[model samples]
Target: MNKSIETMWKQGFISEGELVVPKVNDLYNRKSQNLVDKLQHMFAVNIKAIVIGALLLLVVMSLIGAPWLGIYICILLAPLVLMARQELDKSYNLSKGQSSLEYLESFNAWLHDSITRYAIYYKFFYPLFYVGMVSQGLASDAGTRVMARLLKTYPTDYVFLDIPGYVWALITVLLLVVIKYSAALYRLDLNMIYGRQFKKLEELIKDMRALKPE
Candidate 1:
């Protein structure tokens, strides 16, 4: 039994003369274990999803004659898989013998640090992903035809990096827009996936803290 939970029991959460409350203690233990278990499960699932998604993207891109772009996407996603694995390992290796409160605190700290690091990675990732997709599309046969049509109708006298100035400007603006909002986008994504679990963890920690001695 965790010391914090033991303390909680001693502090009147259970009967006055009783040393233990099977029902209450079990409830807290179950909740704590459940939260940690869910987090680990989610991490495992996320890694699998990324791998499957990457493989599917590679296959689809190959069929569409953009194998390089597919490979590039996989390369971009590789770090994410590695990061997730690191997080999963960390979660598994949380300090032994910690009180429930201390354990939760440790997990919370890990979560915060992981999110901060991912925020930085996403700043570059979102923009790069956008650029890769756009560039790949433009290099495709249909995009080539469209570009030819545009160049024919509009003068190509001014060019940048072999692209018509106007087209290049549009791409640049879009890329900048994606980069500007990448952090927010990452937050939104993170929340969508883990918001419920995060909330539960925080609430559990708060409840545990309230039970501590003054």
Candidate 2:
């Protein structure tokens, strides 16, 4: 551990306690960090997929006109959706790792603080970030459809229903479901870990009472 981190822990900057549970680490205690890292990777992959797929579809649609773009869009969308599912696996593996030492504390206090910290960084930040990505696709789809109508490739009054195109979008929705379910399962595991970490935290609190801040 970094000496600064140790000093902060000692000073109650990170938390007020002695973290006595070392190598016998809990998986739940370290999940949020791993989840953050995996999401970073997934976002990178999504960018590459979006750019490459959109560019390819745009070029093909310009040549063949609108109806064909739907097929082309589907082809491109497949990878984006499939890779997103793959992201869930990455998060799953990330959630399984061990930490060096976890600050043991009361379940109410620790769980509340940890969840609050993570909700700020993960739920708020990540959703805002990913929402921007979904918006990009929606914009691209709208732009393409509108252009197709302008070029006389699509009927002006025709209600657009790209069966294959939506398949790709549906896949993304499915991947999100998988990610959510995995997160829920991980949370269940975390509740169990909270019980153990809380016991360890009580022990550490007792230990702290026996030591001075020398």
Candidate 3:
């Protein structure tokens, strides 16, 4: 119908030649931009949180004579923060000047890959971070005080293991348990952090996929 054709054209849904679906493209582009903005904002907020947390940790470590643990936290998370920045840059770059369904597909793939890598890296390092923190603390004056109190309370002879030894055993068991369930735990954590935003992206991608260019 001529009327329908004219309406489609007016809506920027169809074109005469190679099908330049401007409406669809523009919609996707706006969504991509929104996602990029969210990522940038999230990155900024995460960096701030990391800095604040690091400072607090450093203060605590200093008070407890376990400065190395604070340093370890900074060292571990610094690279991750940088990686997030790089990923954000890549996302923005991918979204630039391109708003087709193909672009949406590529962005979807990129997001999935980036998130997978992030989860992998996070799971790998999370236990190490905890181990370093605990190890450093256990070697500090604070640890000695805690050990003394624990020994006084529990009195090693009961269990045939000293307080510190029992603590080490407990830490080892915890490490094993965490390592075993790290993947699932990381997934839950990621879902908590990015679930809503990721769902939006998925929905946009699905919508774009359904739009067939003529």
Candidate 4:
């Protein structure tokens, strides 16, 4: 429905006497707009889900007497909210004067940049989040009681900072592995969440590109 796309459609009809080219162009234009709209809707839903999920977790954590853990997780998640807002603003501000193909391409580029940016954050965030959860759990009252029992059962030589040295070693190894694969893990998560939309977007872009006039 973009004015530029409308103009392109008119031009295509004028240049080519056959209706096939124009009709195909029109079909792709509609598909492109629909796909973009769907993507925007999905993005908004994802943001809402994050906020709702965070609030629910906060409530659960408070009820469980680990409100600080919930607060820490929310703090960690704050940047994600800002990032999504920035990306959503960018999506809204994408130039409307361009043709459908250009618009879709711009969105596709934005998607890639968004994913890369998130991936970079994930590399650090995943590890920090794990560490936060573990550290917070070990600092809680329940953790103190558990640690006390462990101390009574195990030799002090095998304990470090009230936790078994082996547990610390395992945590360290897990953190290292998470940091190394965090981006890949994020991609997998994203794929699981939006795999169908992603595939459709790719196919739409491919079709639009093929239909583009030389």
Tell me the deviation in Å of residue 77 in model 4.
0.7
Candidate 3, which ten residues in sequence have the lowest lDDT sum? 1-10
Give the alpha carbon lDDT tens digit for every residue of 103-164 in model 4: 67788899999999999988878988998898887899888888888777875677778788
Look at candidate 2 and tell me the lDDT of residue 192: 68
Error of 2 at 82 (Å): 22
Clashes of 3: 0
Query: What is candidate 2's lDDT per residue for 169-212, written digit by digit as tens?
Result: 55468557644554454456445644455455455444543442
Candidate 1, poorest ten consecutive residues by summed lDDT: 12-21
Q: Candidate 1: list runs displaced more than 4 Å.
A: 1-23
Segments of candidate 4 deviating more than 4 angstroms:
1-20, 149-156
The residue pairs that clash in candidate 2, if any, are 104-201
Clashes of 1: 0
Which residues of candidate 2, in runs, are more than 4 Å off?
1-20, 24-32, 67-214
TM-score of every model versus the real structure? 0.85, 0.26, 0.72, 0.86
Quote the lDDT for 131 in model 3.
Answer: 88
Candidate 4 weakest ten by summed lDDT: 11-20
> How close to the true structure is residue 80 of candidate 3, measured as C-alpha lDDT?
81
| Alpha-carbon lDDT of model 4 | 0.78
Which model scores highest in lDDT? 1
Q: Rank the candidates by TM-score, best first.
A: 4, 1, 3, 2
lDDT of 2 at 105: 27
**How well is each residue in 150-209 modelled by candidate 3, as lDDT tens digits?**
888776654333345687789889988877777778789778987888788788767766
